[model samples]
Target: MSSIPELLAVTNLNELSINDFIALLLTVADKTDLHPALKEGLPEYFSGGEKLREMAGNLRQLRDAAATGNREAKAEKMAAWEAGKLAVAMNAQHLTMLSLHRKDPSLLNNIGLELKQRQQGGKSSVNVLAETPVVTAKHVQGPSGPVSGSIVVVISRAKNTIPFEMQMTDDPSNESSWSSQGIHQKSRIEYQELEPAKRLYFRVRYHIDGKTSQWSPTANIIVL
Candidate 1:
């Protein structure tokens, strides 16, 4: 049995291995006092039997791809694995929030908000918690080489006063380290500065009532 501290030590989901995620699933499964929502959803997301094995198999394939230097295969597996991990982590967070509120119903909304903020710490799972903004950009020939056309970002969640951030990167693989153009309150914007033949990657994040969403999937445009 791993100590609570050891499991809780996972500050970043990106740093967690497949095995660690499996162990977390097992831990959650063993808890008898889970909230009704978690109890119902646990089997689909984190069953100690078949679902666990399937995830392990996926991780194995990912490992094999990495060993063989298959970048595309590795990337696909990585994205799938990341998506699964986020789904599971989201459940765990919900369970934590449920547990806290069970002790005192007055702590419901505020605790939920706090747990949400903690979940967003990874940024990868921000979209899971908040609305994922769809972003698009286009590059066109201009007076000076090439320039980006309209950059539009949109999200239609139930919440209001959504904030957003636009980010750009030169390489698709380096989207994790993209530079932010700055935060914006609107869903659409246009800025035209691009170099010819250069491929630009773009993504956007929306904020729901001060909570930042996970960055949207990346969109790219090649300068003419």
Candidate 2:
């Protein structure tokens, strides 16, 4: 067994949630200040920060669209956010790994990474076939608010969990009509400002480790 610590391989940074990815960026950036060792890779080390911020900006557009119930704009913004996030994270991972490469792996502590002691001959990683978690329509609650288009999907949660991506569409038959409702850490999510009297559809999905689950079974509710 190798007594030396090694960086925990986060080979799929794209699988991280946006907020988690941001946290990782903050960690590495902060660590640079404490580690004079990073001086050589300093400039390049921070290069991905700008892209991270831009991806965050794209995320804000998604948030705004979801809040106002502009489903079409929400879809567009979600697409932009996803693409930007993937690109930024992939680039940052490459740069961060390069900066830390060949350095003391103990430096990984508190840098949004875990350190694992290396084995002389590591066991081959096993491929676990990840099954998609199932989600039911659960319950669709009619609007209690005075608003004409407010509706709530009362999803019961067992406890605290990562955000489940919510998506909606006015027409289930139309593939292009689906739009993001943004992510909700809570199980119960409410969507408002929907077009009145329209039959809308909803679904949920989440990512863990390196796998993304298939979209949940579709749920439908008519906007009041």
Candidate 3:
């Protein structure tokens, strides 16, 4: 019988002789260091490490069978390989998220925002709502009367801290022209009595702790 190390050195699939398979099996068995009773329970072909060697021979036979154009065997091996790769990728992603969260606790919040955006059809799931842009004659009467139009916007956040002062802008260059609104934990906003017949643009600004985030994408509302 060839030594365990000799078996591990056999790299050529085409040259996998019976002795080579047995050697490979011995290598695997030696590495596992199974209990004596468990080792004894194995068939004579595997006794003292022969069992593993036989298994290696069987594996080579399967491989040869696959090479001989057994589509099913080839597919099975391919599926196993893909599954192993997927498992590795999932593990990598989990580790990455753990590391990122440790470095920046706010990463979870960002991930939540991404998930919400996906759920909301790829456009920003966050919205801002309001009544009509037209300052209808009825709305001019005051806040007490029924508002003819209302606007509502929704924003998504993973964290408990809500954004401060969501805003709207007609143009990106005119920062001072932006209008402000209060953000709620529910990620929604309502603006009543918007002026009629105007082209209005809206954006959201949020802060975590004291650090402020950039504005959300601007949405345009045309009030009749």
**Per-model TM values vs. the true structure:** 0.37, 0.48, 0.31
Most TM-score-accurate candidate? 2
Candidate 2 at 161: error in angstroms? Answer: 1.6
Instruction: Give each model's whole-structure lDDT.
Output: 0.50, 0.51, 0.40
- Model 2, C-alpha of 11: deviation from truth (Å): 9.3
**What is the per-residue lDDT of model 1 for residues 99-160, given as tens digits with 9 covering 90 to 100?**
56566433222211233445435564454455576777654345975444433334343344
Angstrom error at residue 189, model 3: 1.1
Per-prediction count of colliding residue pairs? 2, 0, 22
Give per-residue lDDT, candidate 3, residue 198: 61
Query: Over 4 Å off in model 3, which ranges?
Result: 1-148, 159-161
Cα-based RMSD of candidate 3: 26.5
Cα lDDT tens digits, model 2, 1-224, are 84422235454455665444443444443443455444554555243445545555566556556657788877876686566545544444554465477554444443433333321212321111122333443223447635567766754332346435566777777544565554456666666677777887887655322223456678787776
Q: After aligning candidate 2 to the native by TM-score, how far in Å is the CA of 94 from where it should be?
A: 4.8
**What is candidate 3's local distance difference test score?**
0.40
